[model samples]
Target: MPTHGVIRRFNDTRRTKEKMTPGDLCLLAHFYGVSVEVMALRLEDLNLLPNGNWGKLKAGGFRVREAQQQLGLGPLPAR
Candidate 1:
């Protein structure tokens, strides 16, 4: 689950229709059920990023885990 602050941030970003961030392309492509190749992401990899947050499998397998914190997304990929 997401924290209140995380939820608030999501809402604010949504309300503002801000520009896309690093991982947004992957998620939006997933949502639209389209190819993610432009983002250099495979459609199958979407499974490793549920709800737009890196899953445990991906967290351990990719450098993205480190980016999560660097990007202020949280420590445990619980975002």
Candidate 2:
């Protein structure tokens, strides 16, 4: 699915911001055993974000951080 679609899903379900959070991206990165930057690059490579915008990726990263705090996921592990 496209990045927007994914973000929408998360937002709708979790009532989060329109943008995807960094914590969300971080969770995905951790699942894939990759860094958040790598995940963002991969998303861009997959044409998930329009025009490969890095700003959206960064916003998503922030959202993820917020989500993590709410969920008590604690600070992300050191890279």
Candidate 3:
């Protein structure tokens, strides 16, 4: 795990905006215990976000907020 200073430097906004370098990629890969190739997959390269309800999304399902307010649906059913 990175110390506070290292993490802070990575997120500092005062610094000029720059693209992630190869070293940054390696750091993230090691942190997540994943390969550099996997870490390199940008969000633009993905059709849908991971760990989300892709089944519902693909079938044109609405999110909780949309279903509740716009469609006037009840709260989510019990698990």
Best prediction by lDDT: 2
Tens-place lDDT per residue, model 1, 1-79, is 2235334444454576654344554444333344333222432243322443334335546454354445454332222
Candidate 3 residue spans exceeding 4 A from truth: 1-17, 42-79
TM-score of every prediction relative to native = 0.26, 0.44, 0.34
- Candidate 3: tens digits of C-alpha lDDT, residues 1-79: 2345434544552254555444454454444555434444431134212333234343564243442344333443344
Question: After TM-score superposition, what is the CA distance of residue 39 in candidate 3 from its true location, in Å?
Answer: 0.5
Clash counts for all predictions: 0, 10, 0
lDDT score, candidate 1, position 65: 39
lDDT of each: 0.40, 0.58, 0.40
Judge candidate 2 against the unseen true structure and give its global Cα lDDT, from 0 to 1: 0.58
Clashing pairs for predicted structure model 2, backbone only: 20-60, 21-60, 21-63, 21-64, 22-60, 22-61, 22-64, 23-64, 23-65, 24-64
Give per-residue CA lDDT, model 2, range 1-79, as digits (tens): 3566545544463565555555666665555565566666766676554555556656645565555566566554667
What is the overall TM-score of model 1 with all chains considered together? 0.26
Candidate 2's error at 19, in angstroms? 5.1
Clashes of 2: 10
Q: Which ten contiguous residues of candidate 3 have the minimum total lDDT?
A: 43-52
